[model samples]
Target: MENATPSRTALGVARMRALHQFSPQAGLFRDPYAIAILGEAAPAAQELEQEDERRQRMRLFVASRARFAEDWLAAAVLRGVRQLVVLGAGLDTFSLRNPYRDLSVFEVDHPATQAWKRKCIADSGLAEPAATRFVPVDFERQSLSAELAAAGLQSTAPAFFIWLGVVPYLTKEAILKTLSWIAGVPGSEVVFDYSEPAANRDAAGQAALAFHAARVASVGEPWISFFVPAELAISMGELGFDEIEDIESGDIAARFSEAPKGMTNNSGGGHIIRARRTA
Candidate 1:
């Protein structure tokens, strides 16, 4: 997916979050910057519609999980975590709307995507936050630690990482390398989402996965890796995480607002996991 245009999936995700803003009241979470980040492409993004029922379900999951991650980050910040690192931060507006006064924010993504996002920010006439730093990185070609350090990230301090919309697009080895590295840092906690293996899915869920998987593959960033919830928990334990909270889609829906009509919050499709290293 290197040297490709900014991910279509990213644009779709941004659109989903932007739609949440229009929901009655504040919706799952408020992000006024979500639509602005689309810039001149806002109308084009709005015009891009999901023609299939399964695709619509997939879109709801995107917004739901984004809400989940942001809520968790807010709680983490309340506990005195002063740093936030966002991985694969495609069109994410958390940095722009960050409410914590003392928190430092970092946005990490592919160079090409980051460049496109910068242009979008400039076109929107929104000033980037002074505390927010962007680190252009290709995980396969460079070291995340080295890149973050070069960008002024403190390795010795506690930090919270928000990793969403990128795990399933990566390989098992790549995911492990990144997670293991995070575990090595003291007081590091990461909240990320991942798809469950097909064996765990029912017939309808499996069909939905097939449709969504094919759609992403067509865009060059296919779903390459998956995990069983049990196996994933064990893997995190082996990696030295002192605490692991595995939340499925159904749980997420119940914890948040009611699901809209025809919205299928299937846990078999994906999960949001938070792991923390206290030692």
Candidate 2:
């Protein structure tokens, strides 16, 4: 993953499309660029076509996550925070599907991924959101703050960053440094997801996480960090976020859970943390 190319961007989008196939009401998202953003070389897509059950689960995951990210962005904009940044942009469509009408949005990712995304959207005749800008940085070579500044970001602006399905791939130092950067900014907030620590692995847990780990490794990416939800809150506070909430994995699924018996853990899940900077 250190040396990436645009091809991986296409792969990322393909994963989303494969997963979205599970949602019976995907059209509700109305993100026209879904197919356009992901392109053709998706490993997940190929896997889904071969296995019906995998496809179904993928769709459910995507639908749930889409709901979370979209709702969070809408709320952030409603709250009057004008700047939104997406780290490890992957194939997320929030910039294209801006629920907030008047906010500045940045999509930051590796150069290969950013280029692939831009070209795909453009080739598909999908125009970027009028308020959107791209910020490409080599996570291995450049400092995130410096790269963002070059892309016209101001540290003083109260910003909201969305980082979904990304934390597990970042090192502990990298994650903490990034958080501290946001904390240094007088008033910034961010939402991201992290994997639970490996110590909690049960038979079910081990299998599920194993599949995920295998998938990432197949694509040259590795899971580098994990957090205990309780520890995550304390770490966030120490790094400068005043509030940290561990949103249950089933929180979003409960909103659309079909089982009257209620939600069950789906292998692994994320923490929907909305941390704010006060100092």
Best by TM-score: 1
Residue ranges of candidate 2 with Cα displaced over 4 Å: 2-4, 7-10, 18-22, 25-30, 39-59, 257-263
Candidate 2's error at 229, in angstroms? 1.3
TM-score of each: 0.92, 0.85
lDDT of 2 at 171: 80
Which numbered prediction scores highest in lDDT against the true structure? 1
Per-residue CA lDDT of candidate 2, range 219-260, in tens? 777777888878878888888888665565556556554422
- Candidate 2: C-alpha RMSD to true structure equals 3.1
Candidate 2, residue 38: CA error in Å?
Answer: 3.4
Q: After superposition, how far is residue 8 of candidate 2 from its true place, in Å?
A: 3.4
Model 2 backbone overlap count = 3
